[model samples]
Target chain A: MKKILNDPAAVVAQSLLGLAAAHPDLLRVTTDPAVVSRADGPRPGKVAVVSGGGSGHEPLHGGFVGPGMLDAACPGAVFTSPTPDQIQAAVSRVDGGAGVLLLVKNYTGDVLNFETAAELLAADGVDVRTVLIDDDVAVRDSLYTAGRRGVGATVLVEKVVGAAAEAGADLATCERVARAAVAGARSMGIALTAPTVPHVGEPSFTLADDEMEVGIGIHGEPGRRRERLTDADGVVAALLEPVLADLPFAAGDEVLLFTNSMGGTPLLELYLAHGIAEQSLVDKGITVTRRLVGPYVTSLEMQGMSLTLLRLDDELTRLWDAPVRTAALRWGA
Target chain B: MKKILNDPAAVVAQSLLGLAAAHPDLLRVTTDPAVVSRADGPRPGKVAVVSGGGSGHEPLHGGFVGPGMLDAACPGAVFTSPTPDQIQAAVSRVDGGAGVLLLVKNYTGDVLNFETAAELLAADGVDVRTVLIDDDVAVRDSLYTAGRRGVGATVLVEKVVGAAAEAGADLATCERVARAAVAGARSMGIALTAPTVPHVGEPSFTLADDEMEVGIGIHGEPGRRRERLTDADGVVAALLEPVLADLPFAAGDEVLLFTNSMGGTPLLELYLAHGIAEQSLVDKGITVTRRLVGPYVTSLEMQGMSLTLLRLDDELTRLWDAPVRTAALRWGA
Candidate 1:
């Protein structure tokens, strides 16, 4: 692909510098390629929270480095998981005296990388806890590969858990909140068009004009199955039924409803899907206490969207309601 | 268009209900049909700031409502401008005893609708002002139409103004800050694929695999011109030159840079663009103080991106640094 970059290899490094330069008050990038943290370091007695993922999901890991969210985030190359060395640096940089927690989305590469970093931190006695988010419902029951590919619910997990951490929750408390968020959330996505990975100038997968792929992964992985084109409502139902059924959420359940664009679908259609999904939940007598509709967790400009629901309780609600000041999820300050 | 909505007319209403239910504490759907605001009225003595546009830009007006960004947002149909009545409703609902300011993007329909509403609010003896956001560098010297259509800078205007409003700036101060933000900002966008409006199932425009449309509007409106597809670096240069030349920013000037996805571009591409754009700025010796890369203000699902630059001063920097808590933009507590 014809790109404007100076050197493909230098993309991540230069971007981090620009990010730090942009929000000096909110973020600080290490001179050596180690970590991206809040402009200020680990607040006293506040258990620091850290997370890392592949680079493409900007604002997810980096934009999220601020007061209310992750204390620090490590970014890797496009859709490629961060190296353990980078994760270890972020862990060391954000480790306040109170300890630290690592929130890892359940991808094979991320799981392995974060796990290795945890071992490294443990060796350093920097007290650490790991919370894995495996929330995507797209991947069907699997005896061979793991079940769901963690997708949209990662944002809610971070926000709720970040609030807990920011409130000076102990590492255990923060980990509990993060785990609860992961357990309560479910997400599924569908794609109308396959995305083109920059390194590869062609589409990752192809779909006919009259066809759409359901249950696709964030990296253009094949979905559960393909079907003839369907309207937004049908797509919503298709996406939501599996999530709702998998979670076994019943009537009167209070949940957070999220409709995420896979980088490509417009918010117009997401709202349309959101409308149908709302009615679907209302008809089922479920109550959604909050709704977040946007491209929170995305696949690079792939024309698709995912619906995520997080069942909420008074505690979860309080955490969700608490003030946050991150670059991505911010509210109630 | 094939849609999931039970009725096209009910889309906004139902979505509002879902939004309110999901964020009862953060947002309320007023009795006036399409207006959504903070559950509570505006803070007394603070400038009541309101923004509204077509509904396709999710998280723009509504998602931005909170303590620091927008006091209220009036949502309209998919791509149609919100009626004056809707804007008026938003003004009355968010107006504290002090007054209200309307941040209208420079789209002809949006400008007309908001201006009429401002006049209506004036008739009620409600203090009001409007800042026209003509930030797009694409449209030039049009005698018949308003200059360039407002693209991404509208969000920066709201953020800076919202900070001023939150800091207890009176209406005039808020207005001054907002207008300054609009004046100092310039943006340009390019489209890789045409977005399909929800009601209009077909693509808004067509492009060959080897072509990309430059200087495009967020709503899939045509750009000043189209060009052969280029690499990410080339695309960034194509977008930045016009914005830089139009503003003629100096070498020592600090800037707040924004790389906004038109809806469909992925984060990886966005970061790559950010990496390249920052280098270009460095080569030019420009001081970039803040950087934001995300799907902040998006078109429905146009496969494109926009670059925005805001030359900053001390007062503007302070306003940008002020604490904000909203569904989208949040800062210090």
Candidate 2:
């Protein structure tokens, strides 16, 4: 695989070095266990929210580390779950007097590791809570997941729940917001090309020139089906049909529609797809009051896009509109 | 090309429709002349900064339009210059009483078209000025350029110069800052794989599996040379040496270092290279007082990156640190 990297084994550690140097005022990175926490010291009585996962889906958990989003992030090797020790380190670095909340994706490895870390934290007398995000509507189970694998909704949950935590909410309130976000969101993605893990040195999967995979997982896992690639309208219909049907969102529903690039898809194509999705929702009588378009959650340079629909309520809308200043998603102050 | 698009020819218009839908608060997009202008009414006495170019570069001219940046952006078809009529339209929409400053890249078509637009506006008694960016340290002349091709430094110039214009600097003052930025900045890129234009349905250029092109142009034009692929450290060295020598950066100089991905390269790899660039500068006793790292200037889904270093004085530094909010770059504001 032709990639701009050195030894594949050192990708995460070296990348953190770069990230730390690039934004020293915003983040403090520790390499031993790879925890990226806010540069500002921890608060004495504020709920500390932490999240993490594999490495490749960048600007995700790590880039989201700051005051308005994740307090600390434990990034493991690409596509591999962070060890329990790494998660424990993140908790140790960010735990304030109030409590800790772990935003865990639904993948089996992430679930297991985060659970182990939570047990360890509890033994240390830390009040920690867990929220699992399983918003993908593509499948009930997958290669590395026991249920619908978490996808793009992870970004929405992180933003909304993190805002609640930042607003001085208690651990229970943060957990409630995260659970609501997870329950209200659904995602589906199509892959035009697969990603190559640095160590793997080759594409994980292969598709013929004219074929595309529907409902593909972030790690290049097989999706629902394979078919000849079509235009953006067809692709948008394929992804949105399953997502909208699963949510069964009806007329007069106001929602936040997020159109995401898998990795290699350019913004031009992604925006084109988003336009089609917007029109489709309008025709269905659903009002799209909020929209996000770009690559927030992504595979490692995989070419395609994912669509996530979050059924929004007044509270969720307030949380989303609240100011956030993370490296990935930045807005008001 | 395996792009998520419909009717390759409609790519620009359709993408702009999506852009308008996604960011109604920050932008007002008109399709007939294809101008993306600020949603807020133009500041009557502030110098209007307008820029446009080919559309393949995702966020260069359009995504950078917002408060404290470009007043308007005109995007043409992929890899083709926008017509003079489109530029005239953008000028009409954003021109305030303080006059218009047109930022043009150093490509033949861009220079010719922007000059023609300026002439048309001048004929109508609109006080208009032009600043051309030629900061690429690669080749002196290439397929589409008459001088060093404008690349990553265009983003730096736009951010710094746009901020100056927003601070109420007049036409001459804005032009002076833009020229200083163009003179002070230097860039060099390396591409592992070339980008493909939708209409052409083929890669702009080709490379063997084990080779990469150093000093590669943004449009996939031939660079200084083709060599075997190497590690990230080697690639960083290759890029930094030419950029440093071209600008003749000194030991005590303070600068802004921008590490950019040319579309398909993941942030993981881009940050790694950035880390290396940081250390290299530190070793040379140069202080990087400012930093911007991302895919701001891209060439569709090209698998590589570019490095830009802008020599900074107090004025440029302050302008760079000023509050500016755009779809691609937003901070402080």
Candidate 3:
């Protein structure tokens, strides 16, 4: 494993230590629960948004923590879900009395842990709501998930709902916006190589030099099929067609198109893919009203890309355009 | 090689097409010579900052084109310097009546091409001043450089000097700040695996699974030596020692610490490296007043990182803290 880590088991904790040091202006870290929260947070009477998941998919839950995005993030170990206690700590730490909304990816572990935390909090009289993001249109069930695995659209949900929460929306309104984001967004990914969980110290799966996994999961779960590697245009189309079909995203639709690198792919190729997706949408008479292209949602050291299209209404569009001050996604603020 | 590309030769062009599509509000792409310029340009008498170099390093020259950063960028083919004509196009496009300052990386090709463009424009009575950045303290002379190779600190120079220009500083003042940034900064990198040049279809260099190259250069240039892999702290020390020694950075110096990834590494490891670097600087009695930790300057998909330290005085610190809204780097604005 040529990863820049001291001990594989301590990767998450140590990385958070680094994150805390780097963005002190934006974040505060709690080691016991491995929660990262807004440095200036828990404002009285304001709704708070929190999300958590396995590590490796960076800038997802943790890097999104700030005033305009996630108020807190509970990061578990690499490819492993955060415990319920971690989720509870994040909720308690960021709750500002209005209520707290949890954005949970639809993985089994995430749903279970977040649900447990929400129940525990509710028993204690803390108002909490959970929105499950099962936006990945890949496999219906996979190694770690019994339904569509949450992927790229998680970033979109956080951005849009975080905007709503930042605008002083109540807990019910925040949950409503979170559901709107989760419902409107869809994602699909392709993997050229598998990600190596740090402790595992080897690729989750191996592929021939000229092969790829279509409809791959964030954690290297088996995809729709193994296929011969194709050019950029073909790759984009293969992923785009399925995503468009699943959403029945058709002509005259408007979208917030996001072309994201899984991990190892550079912006040169990611943007190349983004351009092809744009052209494909243009040819279909779909208008790309907003754009996001980068390695925002990633699988650690995995070489691939995921395309996400969020059918935006006036509200989601306005929220997305709202100023955000996160470590990863920032604009308009 | 597994890469997300259509044609190796078309990667730069297609990526820019995607870039233009993704950031229409921020940029305007010109294909003839391949330059990315700010969509809102030629602000009457604002001194424009222009930088260019080989491609492959995303978010360096091209991604930095916008308000409060480079006014325009000229990108060449992968790891190859921009041609004189490309540089000329960038100069003519972004130059306002005030003047144009060229930030050239200290590579033979970059220096030659940018100098040619500056001289051609200078003869035509368009004011121009060129600042050469040679901040990499890895090796005196390497594969692509005669003096010190320009590495991670290119981002710092563009940022500080770009801020100076954005504030309407004269061309001379902007050039002075650029020079000051270059003089204060130093960088060193290590590569565990070589990056694959898309056209080459092979690793730039091969390494055994457990071995790593110390003091490696961007573009896969061989470094000081090859040795067994070490932990993150060890890896960081290997880089920080030389960077400190080269500058003879003192105990009381306040600096901006930049821990940059070489593309393939994820944020988990990169931030871990940043934390180690921060501790190392603290141990040396150095105060890190500002920090930039991410894969801002990259070499395609190389699995390694570089550490850069820019000793900041009051002016440089203020300039560094100024707003920048490029595709990659943005804050305060």
Candidate 4:
């Protein structure tokens, strides 16, 4: 696959160096490659939240390491979850006097690694809480496959729950908020093209120019459905309908709508999908109090989009409106 | 080229509808195909800041809209700047009791469109100021060839200067902060593979499996140099040497380093680059005060990376630390 680095093996290391140089105030890297955190460390008494995953998704764990997001993000190789050593180091680095929370996405490697790290840290007497995000609506039931992959809803989980963590909310409250976001959220994606994995140097799945795949995961995994290409409105409806049906959102329910691009779809198209999504929500009598349309949670260079809706309560809405400071999701004056 | 868009022409309109539906509390669609603030109207007597560009770059002008970022963002067609009419409407919608400021990237189209909007707004007795971000060090010619094309540094400008504007800093102060960031910053990028523009339907440029393009732009524009791929440490040096040399950063100079993926790069690689860059900065005696590593600004699905450095002073540091409330950027309690 085409890429910009001198060597694939060195890509992660060089990129981390570049990141540290770029936002020295907000992030710092440990010498052992196990920890990345705000240079200023955690705020006093606030529970430190640490998250990690394989590295293909930018801004997921790293760009999210800041004031209102994860205290530190440990990135592993592309599509490979970080080693237990890395997670344990991150736990040690960000474990302030209050405690530390581990936000692990539902991917098996991520969960297993974080779980192991939690045990090791527990043995070391570090207070830790682990929150597992399993919000992808696409379910894979087979002997060989892990359950449903954590797709685009991970971004919303980070944003809402990250704010709660930053508000001096304890580990329990943050975990509650995160769980609420996970339970209230559902995401469905459709891909028109298969992405080339860098290591493989070829397309993961070949699709005709006119064909599209639905329910894609972050690793270019095959979607749950494949069909002939559809118009923007139809595509948006196909994505949103499944999510709404599964979540069963009620009328007048305030929601946070996130139309996420899977790497390659332009903002114009994402916004177009956003429009259709808005109309769909209005037609369904759902009140969308907030919206985020962009490539927040993405698959690597996949040309597609996902629609994520978080059913909001008064608390979720207020938490969503709270201020945050991170390398990626920052807002509030 | 591999995009999932239905019709390239309808992408913008569709996306605007989605944004309106998604964030009714944050954005409202103007009749003229622009997204305006949902906050009644622009506050009376506040200096309105407006920004925009092509639709491919997400979380830019659109995500940066809130109390601190742009009052409104005028999104154009994918990879194309908005027309004067759209800018005029955006300016009008966001113009409050105070004046308006146009924060523009240094591309020719963007500069021209925003300049025209500024002139038109002035004709209507709206006070307007324009700050052009020309931080990309890739361009060597200042007296010719449009100088430098604005890339990832635009995010920093918007956040820091947006915070100033949100805090009631006058147009002059905001302008000064914006310019300070522009002057103190330098960026350079390299593309591994070019993105497929929606209309083009193919890669903008081609490279051998082993070759790399250095000094590239956010779009698929060719870079100043191309060479055989090297190791990550060497690549980081190649990306940063030019920036440091061009800016003449010396020992003890505190800087902000940004490792920006030109769309398709994995965050794992970005963090690797971050580590290498941090070592380089330390080795060269440069004290980095901040770092941001991710795809903040992107070029469709281009596979590449860019490095940005901002020389920080006390004022810039303070402004950088200021709280901001936008869709993408938020900080403080």
Best by lDDT: 2
Candidate 2 lDDT by residue in tens digits, A15-115 = 99999999998899988999999987487788999999999998888888886888999999999999999999998898887999999989999999999
C-alpha-based local distance difference test score of model 4: 0.76
Clashes of 2: 0
- Candidate 1 wrong stretches, greater than 4 Å: A1-14, A28-35, A38-48, A95-100, A113-129, A140-144, A160-177, B1-18, B30-33, B42-47, B95-100, B115-128, B141-144, B165-171
Give the lowest summed-lDDT range of ten residues in model 2 chain A. A324-333
Model 2 residue A207 lDDT score: 90
State how far residue A113 of model 3 sits from its true place (Å): 0.9
What candidate 2 gets wrong by more than 4 Å, as runs, is: none
Error of 2 at B186 (Å): 0.4
TM-score of each: 0.87, 0.99, 0.99, 0.84
lDDT of 2 by residue, B1-333 (tens): 798999998999999999998888999998888999999847899899999999989988889999888999999889889999999999999888899999998999999999999999999999999999998999999989998999998888888888998889999999999999999999999999999999999998889999999989888898999999999999999999999998799899999999999999999999999999999999999999999998988999999999999999999999898888888888777
Misplaced by over 4 Å in model 3 are none
Instruction: Assess the local accuracy of residue B260 in candidate 1 as a C-alpha lDDT between 0 and 100.
Output: 85
CAPRI tier for the interface of model 4: acceptable
DockQ of each: 0.39, 0.85, 0.85, 0.43
> lDDT at B123 for candidate 3?
89
